[model samples]
Structure formats: C-alpha cells, structure tokens
Target chain A: MTEGLSEAGLIAVVCEACGAPRTPIGPGDDAALVIAPPRGRQVVTTDALVEGVPLVEGVHFLRAHPPEALGWKALAVNLSDVAAMGARPSAFVLSAAVPEGLPAAWWGAFARGLAACARAAGAALVGGDTVRSPGPLVLNITAWGWTEGDAVLRRDGGRAGDALMVRGNIGRSTLGLLNWLKLAESGWGVDGAVRDDALAAHLRPAPPLDAGPWALAHGASAGMDLSDGLATDLPRLAAACGLVLEVELAALPVDPVCAGLTPDERAAGGEDYGLAVLVPAEHVGAFIARGFASLGAARQPVGGERPGVLWRRHGAPTELAASAFAHFSGG
Target chain B: MTEGLSEAGLIAVVCEACGAPRTPIGPGDDAALVIAPPRGRQVVTTDALVEGVPLVEGVHFLRAHPPEALGWKALAVNLSDVAAMGARPSAFVLSAAVPEGLPAAWWGAFARGLAACARAAGAALVGGDTVRSPGPLVLNITAWGWTEGDAVLRRDGGRAGDALMVRGNIGRSTLGLLNWLKLAESGWGVDGAVRDDALAAHLRPAPPLDAGPWALAHGASAGMDLSDGLATDLPRLAAACGLVLEVELAALPVDPVCAGLTPDERAAGGEDYGLAVLVPAEHVGAFIARGFASLGAARQPVGGERPGVLWRRHGAPTELAASAFAHFSGG
Candidate 1:
C-alpha cells in the first residue's frame, strides 16, 4: 500500500532532512527568524511562480521534473536575488498549493531538494503554508538575508567608464533548453553526459553564491545576475546606473557549445544564471588578480559606454541587436 | 485604451491607498519590518483560503464580493489568530493569485478594503505578492503581533476543572451563509439591515480582537477563536488542553438569527469568529466582572469533564456528533 500523507506530513519529512536550526522559531510558529548581522542591513525579496507563465509542465521542465529539483529551483531563484545584494541568505518562507492526492514520495523528494538547497545556501527553512489547489502546482518563496557593512551592491551605481564583467560562462541553460526541445521534437537520444549536464543546467541553474561578496570586496560599481540574459540585463544595469553601455563585439565570450548555434539562437535564449557587474577601471586589474584566480576566469570587458552590445564575429566588431533572454512584453 | 498596468502597478495602487509609507525596505525588498515591541514577544499565525473550499463565487459572499473584502478577509482571519493569542496585530504579508483580466476596479476596491481593514486593526501591510492564475483566486495571509509581560495565552494551558467561557455570540457567520444561500435559492430578497449585517458577517467577519488581550490580562487559561464554529473549534481547544470540554447547551450564546435556525442547521454550520477560552474557577468571577462585562456578557459554564464535547438540548445531555466544520474525520 502507498503511504497516504497529507501536506503536513510532507513538511515534517523535509524539515527532518534540513537539520540547520537557524530559525529560533521554526515551522509551526507563526513566523521564523534568522539572526541579523549586528552592523549590516537585512534584505528581503519574494517571487511567485504560476503554472502557465515561467513554469509550464512538459515545457519549462519535464512533466516529471524531480520534485526535489522543483523545490530547489523555487528557493534558489530567490536566493540569487539575495546574493546579488551581497547578502548571505538566512531564512525563507514558502507557500505552496498542490493538487490533492499528489504522491507522498513526490513531496518527500521536493522537500529533500528544498532542504539541500537551503543548507547549501546557508539558509534555514523558516516557516510556510501548504494548501490544496484546483490548478497546476504553485510555489511562492520569500527569502531574507543580511549584509555586514555598506558593501551591498545595487544596479544603479555603475559609472560610464566602469568595465563590465560577468562572473561565469553564460548560455548553458539556454542551450540545455534548446537540446531538450530538440530531443522532444525529433525523438533522438543524446549522449548521457551531455543530456545530464543540459538537464541539470535547466533544472538547477547555478547562481554564483560567492560573486556578490567578491564584487563587494573588490569594489564592483554595480551588479545583477543575468537571469534574463546579458543583452536584456545589461540594458537594465545601464538604465539603473544612468549611463549608456558600450560593448566591443570582438571580445564577446560565447560558450563552446553555443558556438555551433545560429547567432540569433545564441542571442535571445534565456536562463544563463551568470553574474554581471561593473568594476571601476582602477579596481579592474586587482579584481583580475584576486577575483579571477578565485573564480577561474580572467576579468574581461564585454561592454563599455557605447550605445549597445557589440560582438566580434570572424574578427570584426558588429552590433548585436539583442541578447538571448525573455522579456516581459505583456504576453 | 485600457490601463495596461503591470503587476507592479497594482501593488503601487494598493500601497498608495493604504497610506502606509512604503518601507525604506518595502515589498520589492526581501522582507519588511514595522517597529516590533522591543521587550515583548511577537505573536504570529497564518491562514489560507482556497476557492472551492472556504469560498465559492456567488455562494459564500456574492459574485460581486468586493476585491477589498477578499483582501480584508485574507488578513482578518490571520489577525483573528493573533487576537486569539492576546496580541495586538502589527504587520501582515499577503500572497494572492487571481485570474487575468480581473477588473482593475475590482482590484481598486480590494485594495481599498484591505487598506481600511489594516488601518482599523492597527496593522500595516508590510509586503505581499500578486500573480495571474488560471483558476479561482487563492489568498494566503500571515499576521504578526506582539504582547507585553507574561500576557500571551496558549491552547495547552487549560486545567481540567477550569470554567470554559466564550466571548460574544456564535454562529452568526454560519447563519449569514445560510441566509444568503436561502435568498439565492428561493429568489427572495433580504431586507436592507438584515442583508447588510449578513453580508458584513460573511465579508468582514468581526474577530474578538480586544477579548484576546482582555482574557490574557484577567487570567484566562486557554483560548482560541471560533473560525471553525463552536462545535469544531471547542473540541480542538479541549483536546489541546487535554481536558474534556462539556459545553452546556443552555449557555451557548447563539445569535438571535441562529436561535431562529433549526438545531441541525445551527449545529453543523461554522464561521462564528468568537473567542472561546477557559478560565480558572477562582478567577472566573473577576474575569466576568471586569473583562466580560466591558466586552459583552459574563462567562458561563457550559459543560463538565467527560471524554468529549457533550451538549444538553431540551434538558437532556448527549454526545454532540462531530459537525461538518470538522472536515477531517476521527476528531
């Protein structure tokens, strides 16, 4: 016989796996708390995912996307925001709605994934509510964190002469989604390693957890994560900082996997999960020496005070109309 | 052209109506705070409402039930929980999903109602999220409050011989639901005053906010609000306290409308929103003389210790069967 557990049962199962006791007041309490840094400020943000937008079954992820990955993704995306602010995540509250009769194992995996992510992010699952829903599953997570000092970064601080740098290689998740779509449409099997990495990238896109602090310590003028894509995010960063961003097309860094794709395909695809920031010219060399050694990359400028993103193809600089990312264009 | 506002627009509109200053750290921030009591404990609770469960369009309130009322109800129910703990509500966070194209006017009214309710309750709308859904709207609200000294009350503190007491009349919301149902079914219009009260009871159910602090101040043992009706909430209170709660049928303060209902209708219906508490026998008179008189009525012993709730009707005592309000079996 299958175990017939309710929402409360699922919560208990996951809470057991997530053993960190950061919350003096945990689940079952009205609210949970994480210790605040004595001198720093606390940051909080919330995001909601509905079934149709941003999350569609059999499209965004598999219809059977590991429940744990679902849970992890839900919290991880919010944590990225905290990381962007150069804060260490401390607590999170989740509110979820699931259709009745969802399997207990599904919830177990979901909770396990959530717990694992929370532990990895140095956060505690504080408190949340669960209820039955008549539609597709919905998860809304609220994350809180604190930073010690006035080192928190915002997108509005970039300067005209600052160098634009990104923490990691981009376009992996977009490629993964493309691969998945190709597989689903053509019924062709890919190599195990390739499929695994692609799916992992889509399911658990890595956000640079240490990048926020690294940038703060090294004097990054302004920064944000490239959840939308460099093309879209850079414009936002530029707008926030009240400057025009110029890019040298010849210096554009494209993933090896992306090299094989059509330029358009490589331009507008979303979900890169890379960190982008502006560093003043004076700090750029020091950042390259200390930060690049840590992140395993040489700090490279992708853009400057130009009007738009420019990319070099075949050794010639060319303006790229847009980068790979989805825009909220009132669909 | 119609106002094509984004999700952010809706939030700004509501926040403006609330007249609560947008926190230096507001909704877009990771979390929000109001000045919590420095020396006292914070009270907290959460409640969720699903479309088909606690509410059905046109059945529960009206198809035209103002959006503001829905927002108010979302916060109010959780506020009732804080009040049950004898705490003054300070802040609330709301999460909601509504069908796309839900009228802007509806949203405006909803925000107005939410603002009014928050102001009246002395609570601030600290943060919330709104999303578009494909199904009926769902609202989940979390409320936090604070209490001074050793004044907070809990459900586990009642002794076996303590006198069970309730503040305010019960079964009004339930009657209101029934009356609305009758009006809908019979095609009969309700009188203005009756309609107004019934709708008010359904839309803006009065919670015993003051009674919570009063009961705690005057030495009430265990306390909880009657959201699940007296029949259901009382039993849980009894179980939590590990005592048999024998409610004297004669002392059950039924509303005048409830008094007119059939016994079965009154018994199975829920939504009283009154405070049910246990007071020690010694302090019962004091509570009655001070707290109860100032509030509404005096405390009356309803029943004696046995195993479960026993009700006396027509001078004969019998086990009261589990009411419909106890949605789960084996209560």
Candidate 2:
C-alpha cells in the first residue's frame, strides 16, 4: 500500500502472503533453489491474447465489457490448458498492456477478477507485468502446475480400440454464443439468464477441473479440452491416439438449444469448454457411471474404433463433411 | 524451430529442456502447486512497456529494434528487481502482444532474446502467453527470484553512519543516450560501437548479477540500483535509511565522457545500471575494496554522514542547486 516502494518492496509483501517452503535459498538470492519432489513433474504453459485478433471490440464481447472479465478470461483460458493436461493449477504470472489514462477502477476490477479466478482455481496470482499501449488491450497468462503418477494426459495417447467419451453435454456454450449473436443482430436484448450464460461462456469459461482429475484417476487413455468445437477437437484426439474415430451421429449429445440449429452450424460452432476422454472399450460402461457421478456429466461414447467421424441421426449413422472448426475458415 | 506449435507447445519443449523436476501435486491435475518455500517469505514484481510509450517507432532504433531485444529488455528490467534484492534469480514468464502480419522473424527473435536473458540470469523461461494485437508491440516480463538469508538488503536499511559505495561508473549509459539523441536530431550517423552501446544499454541492460550476492555475502546494510539518476536514487536511499546522504560531487565518479556536462545534466542523467550500497562504518574500507574488485569499479567515499548531497568544486564542498531526476514527475 505504500507509495514509491520499489518493486522489491512489493515483492516482499507478496512473498509473505505466499509463504513458500524454505530452501537453502529463497527469493532474495541470485537464483532461487527448490528441492524437487520425488515423483511429481513440473508442468508449465502460456497463452497470449491480442485485443483485435482473438477478440474484436464488438464481436468477442460488448464494447462495455468489464475489465474484470477481460482479466478473468485471460487467466481462465490458461487454466483451461492445465485442465487439458489433467494437471492441477499452481501459480500464475500475468502480463498486460492497456492504453494509458485508463481508469484506476478498471485496473482494480481487473485485479479483482484475477484474484477471483485464482481463488476458484486454487492457484496464486504470484507475479505479473503491466505496461502502457497504444493499441487494443492485450493480456498473457503463464501458469505452472504439477502432477504425480501416470495421470498426466496428452493428446497423443489415445489407442485404436479406445471408446470416445466426453465429460458433459456439448453445444450449450456454442448455443449461448449463437443466441447472443442473433439477439445482437436483431436489435433485441435477450433475457438476463440467457445473456449471462452466453456472456459467461464467452468471457469466463468453466474448465472441467473435476473431469480432468477424474479421467486421470479412472484410466483415461487420452484426453483434451473441447476448445475449438468437437468437429475439430475430435480429430486431434484421434490423430494423437494413432487411429481414427468413427463418431456415431445418433449418439452425439446435442444440447436442446443446439437442436434447432443447422447441421453445419452445430458441427462448426466452438466455445464448448468440455473435456473429451478416450476410455478402453471394456471400461466404457463403468467409466460412464463413475465418471458421471464424479464429474456430474453423462460420459457417453460418441465414436467407435473405425477412423473418421460418423454422425448418427434417426437411429442411423451418417458420415460428416469436415473434421473440425477453423477460426478463420467458415464451416 | 518448428512452426505451428502453439505457445503451450513451446513451453512444454523448454520445460523438458530444463529438466522437468517433480513439482508438487498441483501442476498436472487442474492447476499448479507452488509450495511457498519453507519460509513464509517471497518476493514479487512486474513491469510493462508499450511500443509507443517508452519507444517511438523510428526514434528508438534503426532497422526497427529486433523483437528479440524487446523480449530481452522486458525480462531484463524485471531481473533488475531481483538484482536489487541481493537475491538469486529463478523463474520468469513473459506475456507479449504483437501486431498482426508481424514477421515470424520477430517472434523467433523475441523468443531467442527471452531464452538468452533467462539463461544468462540463470533463470528458466517457464511459461508465457502470446497474442496478436492491432497496436504497437507490448511486452511484460514477470520474474521471481529469492535469497536464503533473511537479511535481504532493502532501501530502508541505510543508517546515519553508513558509507555510500556504488558499483560501476555512472553516466556512461546516459552519455550514450545523449549521443544517440544528438545523432538523431542532427541527422548525423555515428560510429557503430557508440550506437550499439547506446542501443544495447537502452534495449538489453546488463544487470549486475554478481554484485547482489557479493553485497549480501559481505554484509551490506542497504543497497539498490541506480535506475533513476544518482541524485534521485540517493534521496530514496536516504529516505529508506532514515538519514541524509551527503554526496561529494567532486568525488562522484561521473564517467569521463560525462565530466564536461552541465551540473544539472550530469546530476539528473540516468540509465547507469550500477549497484549502490550503504556499507556500515565498521566495514566501510573492506566493503569498498571488495565491492570494487567484484564490480570492476574504482571505489571512493563520496561523502560522510551529512544531511544532504554536497558537491566539491576546486577542493571545497559546495551545495548544488538542483535535485535528481524524477521519472514520473518529469523533473
């Protein structure tokens, strides 16, 4: 709280709050030294967002979107990466660039959002940098988490005989986005809950924290987050497993909101934020029951051992056109 | 070197290179686990820079400063924080926002700079985020480092009788800047070494890494870096020590190139990148001798216990009329 305290002073206060275990050397030396735990491996990831690229002033969120949401989203997306790895979140560092003369209230809201997300994710906002910019707001969040045992999931771990399963119903978040776009285009303001769900999905996506751990614990062969929409995400999973997945269209769990959408729209829409897992054929049923209980989502097998996606409709499977969603290429 | 690998992929590779030691249970599960080292103490700091703010397009550098230098500078400035703590440098993360269509060379250079600085500082580039922006380049580097001993030197640690000692000559970097400005103003091209030194000092400052450990090891009572002009930095040291620093201007080791400058110009100049220490009276001589040897600078007692900065002109001490540089205040 003191004014003009150098960066070191600020660090001292934050360090006290962190209360990291002591080593032969700690933060005040040339390089900190820590004893690595015997079994756990350090995992790290980074994500960066530019104001106009991934987020346009009007398209990503309303122009009046709160700075807190911006900050929260920045941290949340990176947390999603940790979730994709089936790893726990640990510490995070933020790097932000905002236009000069932005209100201090905005900064405060941003920090508050960061704190809220860090608390919810059980991670610490350990350190970060802020700078002035002449362009759109840009933020990058770097996260570090650890995991022990073979629970670590990678995109390249699925097997040919693996049964495809997902943590939750897909398309809800995508539907939320479509609903917002429709309302915005029609000049009709949607209801608060619909707006909230859509905005929240767009701004503060809920990464499947529990699902990641549960899948890891239950022997998921391969897993990843449904960030780029199922059509795109599934192929990556299949490729990683060194096989092809014949997705049955009838078994695809479409959200009621997405039911009315055209097939192409449903296939290509993104922002799902769900976890997809590959389970051995034998454990499919048990994983469904246990995983649903643990993750609060019905883990349905959406695909078979054959390569490529097959959409099932009216009790019959049909081959789909494309494998995934490309952000720039219209589906 | 491969393209198409996302930021997360790059970090995974680097983490592997650094030897992924077992971390706590958090990282690979849902978040990360960063145990507060045994001591309930930590140090934290952040810094940010926008392209137009600290660096104007053509004015900052010719050939458009490499993205690598930008990245290196971002991290180096923060490393200066760790150095000031007399602490060891540890881990760092970077967040960057660059304009769209920026060459891949820019990204590569930026990453190389980050890696080079991290390696030199003995810290690992653990993670970071990158995104496209419509604005000028923006970079933020957040670094974490620590010390083993609890007696980390602080700005407020100076005492009444502590002898003021500085590592490295002051004003060279400032002189370099003035030369560059002159060249720019006059359209006069300069020698390569002068231009390189000026740009390098401004772009990729070499923080005194060993000085911190030496000061801590030798029992320095108080210390900090000369980021702002000595005149301003000295006042801060005085305020922190709760005593006045009576600096003898004649004895001040101004770089020979800066000797003929006006008093105000000489006093308020910055970018020295030198360490300043307040040695206790009992250890003054030894501290100066050892500090000089370690820092490769000639040491002299600038002033004794006094109320304020005093200058010597023609063998007698005289009070100067001007104050030190204030970065935000534009003094």
Candidate 3:
C-alpha cells in the first residue's frame, strides 16, 4: 500500500519547491501577492488538459506517462500562449481537479516538474488550488507575462504579402501519439531513440520560447503558438487577419521522426506546440538566418474569397484535409 | 431536441458578452493583453467547482441549480479570495470542462451570470478555455486583483490580542445545502421564502467584497475569507500566527435559516464565503459599527501549546465539533 499525503501536505510541498521568487506573499494564504508587471501590459492565457480525450486515447493520461510530464505539459501549454504573445512570463496560478487515491509521490514529482518549467521560463508558481473530483483529473493553468510598450504580438496583425514562417518541428507530437496508441493496441515497436524522441515530443513539448519576442523585435507582424496543427491553426490566423494563406507544402521543415507521413497528415497533426509567425517578405532572409522555415505567404482575398488556407504542392494549387480537431463537435 | 453550441460558438458568446473592458487585446488572440496593475502589487487566487461534491449531495450540482447560479458561484468564490486579500479584482480567466450535450441555453445563462458578477466587482472576464470532458463538469477560475502599497491582507498578520471577527451570515451555505438535500431526500420542507433564500445562499454566494479592504485600511491585523467554515478556517488563521483562537459561540452571527442547528454544527459548516479578520481590541467597536460581528480573539499559548482553537460558552471553556470539511481526505 502506498502512503498518500493529505491535501495540506501536498500544498506544503508545492509551496516549498515552486513558490514564486518575486512574490511578496506566496501560497498558504487566501491569495498570493506578486509584484505587478513593470511594463504596464499583462499577457494572460489559460488552457486545460482533461484526462483522456487527446493524450492517451482511453486510459488515464496521468497513468500513461510519468506524472511529471503531465505537469510539465499542463504549464508549458499555457506558457506557449504567453510566448506567442511576445511576453515574458511572470507568474501562474493552477487549479487542479484531481480524483482521490493518487499517490503522494506523484504530486511531489508534479510540483518539481512545474518548478523546473517555471524556472526555465523565468516564471513563478504563485498560487494553486486542488480539489477532490469524482471524475478524471483536470489541470487548468492560467499564466501571465509582461510586455513593454507596443511589443506585444497578435495573430491578427498580419498584412497581405507577409511570409508565413514556422519555428520548431511539425507532426512529431502526432507521431508520438500514434506510436503510443499503436503500441497499446497492436504491440507496434520503434527504435529506442526514435521512441524516446517521439514520446518526449508528445509528453514534454518545448515551445519556442524566445522566437515570438525575437520575431516581434525583428518586424514580424503576427504570431501564434501552434498547439493545434498548422492545418487547423493557420486558417485561424488567416481568418483573424481577413486574408488567405498560401502555403507551399514542399517547403515545410518536416521532422525526421515524422518521415514517411504524408504532407497532409503532417500538416494536420495536433499538439506540435511550435511558433508560427507572419514576417514581411523583406525580413524573410533574416528570419531564415535565425532558423525560421518559410512555409508560404499571406495574400489579399482573391475575387471575394473568404479567409482560409490555400495549400500548394509542387508550386501548384492543392487541397488538404480539413482540421479534425474541433472540441465538443465529436466529429 | 435541444440544440447545443459548438465550442467556437461558445467562445464567441463569451468574448462578446464578457470581454475585459480595459483590455486592449481581448479574446480571439492566442492570449489576451490587459493593462497591468498600476499599484505595483497583484493578488492572485484560483478555485474550482466539481460535479458531485458538497454542492448538491449526490446529483450533478449544475443540474440541481440554475446553470447561471453555478457560474456565478464559481467566479464569486474566486472573487472572495481576492477580496480577502484586500485587493480590487481586475480580471479573471476561466477554464471549464463540460460534457457533450449540455444545451446552448445553459452556456448562455452561465456566461450571463459570469458577466453580472464581473460587473459587480468592476472586473473583467478577460479570457477562457472550454474543453470536452468524458467525466463530470469541472469549472476552474483564476482571478487577479491589484493592491497598492502595503494594503494586502494575510492570514498570518495577527497579533495575540487581536479580536477575531466575522462579516456576513454564518452557516447560510450549509443551511442551503442541507435544505437542498432534505428536499430531495425525504421531502422535508421549508417555507417558500426560506427555501429560496437558502438555495440562493448556496448557489450565488455574494461575498463581502467591500469588507476586507475596508478592514485592512482600518487597521485590522490579519484576515481571510470564511470559505471552509469558522471551525476549520479560524484555526488556520490562528496557526499561521502561532496563536490559539478562542471563540465565543454564543456570540456567533449564525444565519436565521440555521436557527435550529446546534452551535457546533453552525461553526462546523462550510461555504460561508464571508470575511473573517483579526482586529485590534481597541478597533473592534469600529468594525462592529461597520457590520462586522465579534466572535472571538487570538491569544498566545499558555504552556507549550500548539496553535489551535478553543470554544467558550457562558464565559467558560467548552468544546466544539471539529471541522468535517476536508478536501481529498474523503472524511
């Protein structure tokens, strides 16, 4: 039998290990108090991971991987939003709805994971609430960051003729998820290094933290974190800016792990957690020099064409599958 | 057949109805950008409400009450934490996990409730995320507020001789929960007005938002919101300050709806959502004049005594039932 710590003990562990360094008042109070962002602008975003929908398919996601990874993904996803806005993360508050009977060690590792991620981002875990749930674990994280003056980025700031660029791997997380499902269903196997890389991609996504601010400083017009696949997310950026995106499928920097996957499959894969930006055509060379891969360009709508994505394979017009990641649509 | 809104439609509704007023970059972006607290200090807190816990006994609490009320309570509870910290709420981000098939009208009402509460607090609903859940509905709210220059309150700021005081009705929420359960279980009944009041208490808790900052400005030593009942929360304030709390039960401001309840039962109840503070003995009169009720005082331990609470009746030592609301303990 495992000895599980009480809620109070878990709170104590989190406070001791993950307390905000700049916070004047930390956890164990009604609310945590932290120094306000000095820039006079605060970037805020929230995201949640439910137990089984997208992570592990059928099993409890926490049990599928190390609990620390779940904690990392939970906070990292929200941090991706802050990073996408060209802001520097300051603090976060987490509210977890956890079922009873999870081991105390699981919580300890979870806190350490969050602490490690926060430290990497120069952020602090300022406050959290945990409650007993009769359902699967739900982790919701709200992260805030600081943006000075007019440095904040937006997905709708793109102009016609801006080049669409991406930083980080595409479809690796999808490959990872497929491998996990295949292994569980049919004993599918891969090389140890490939398996580890794919699993890490799915479980502990490393968002391109510095790219958004750097791009903003270098004249990128619009940006978003690619949590959903580019197939799904690119259209959203296009629609927000009231333009059509022309994507050159052959130009995509596909990951080696996603080799052999179709271009459509790679483009539609979710959970990539990368950075997608729109930069002026003139800055494309600088962006490429800084490791950004050009995918395509935004264009003015032609002949009343609604905002959408237009994929071009081998420099000709093409059609890709629609995004299949609509929440609550159950499609 | 009832129609349900897709997640996109729901997000549109929330953005239209509850978008932050002070936010320059509102929802629909990767992240929202709002003016940072000008006071240089920020207060942050989070809370969650689940499906089948203390709210409505065994049924889905959301179904038992109006969805609007549940939404109001969810945000209100977090607002209570902000108020307890002597800060003015500025913005909130909500993460909701909803099962498939909840009606569109349910979500509409929920958003309206949230908007009403945000309006009352002079705050804004800045951002949110809605995810599909395979289990119970869980609503987690993270709210933030601004505090200027040394005005924030903490539970550990009490001195030994400070009077323990409370504002707002005690045990009303417990009364509400009991009435809800009794009406469902044995058909035990109450008058229409009483039932309405009790149900409202449990569902839409109007926290004493003005009391905390007022008390802090008026020289209160320490404070916290009475979330988990006096029996549980008072001792927490005492323990934080290395003192023992002495409660005068006969002087408690118990709700009239809980008239027949035992004093111990009233004190042991949960979800009062009121302000509890330690005011200096000299300023107790002013606090009383301003609608606070005297309940007890904090005192130093007499002989190597651990921080705890003592009950007194008729000016003599007595015993009260220990708090029964322990999260994750399943007690």
Q: Which residue pairs does candidate 3 place in steric collision?
A: none
Give the TM-scores of the predictions, in the order they appear: 0.77, 0.72, 0.89
Interface CA RMSD, all predictions: 4.7, 6.5, 2.4
lDDT of 3 by residue, A1-331 (tens): 1247666676677776676543236677889987764554788999877787444242326454567777777888888889889887888888877777777777777777787788888888888887766877788889988775656888888999999999988878877776676665654343222337777787777888888778878899999989878887999899888999999988888577778577777788888888999999999999999999999999999897999999999899988745433320121
Compute the lDDT of residue A285 as modeled in candidate 3.
96
Candidate 3 wrong stretches, greater than 4 Å: A1-3, A13-24, A53-62, A105-108, A186-195, A321-331, B1-3, B13-24, B53-62, B186-195, B254-258, B321-331
Model 2 chain B: lowest-lDDT 10 consecutive positions: B292-301
Error of 2 at A19 (Å): 15
Say which candidate scores most in lDDT: 3
Estimate, for each residue in A138-236, the C-alpha lDDT of model 1 and write its tens digit: 677777666667557677677767887776546566666666655656553543223466556656666877887678777987777667666566667
- Among all windows of 10 consecutive residues in model 3 chain B, the one with the lowest summed lDDT is B322-331
lDDT of 2 by residue, A132-244 (tens): 45666666667656566545776656675677787654656665665555566766454322246545675566777767666776787777777767677776666555566
How well does candidate 2 score on lDDT at residue B124?
59
**Comparing 1 and 2 on DockQ, the stronger one:** 2
Candidate 1 scores an iRMS of: 4.7
Tens digits of per-residue lDDT for model 2 on B195-255?
3654466556687777766786787777777776676676666655557565655555545
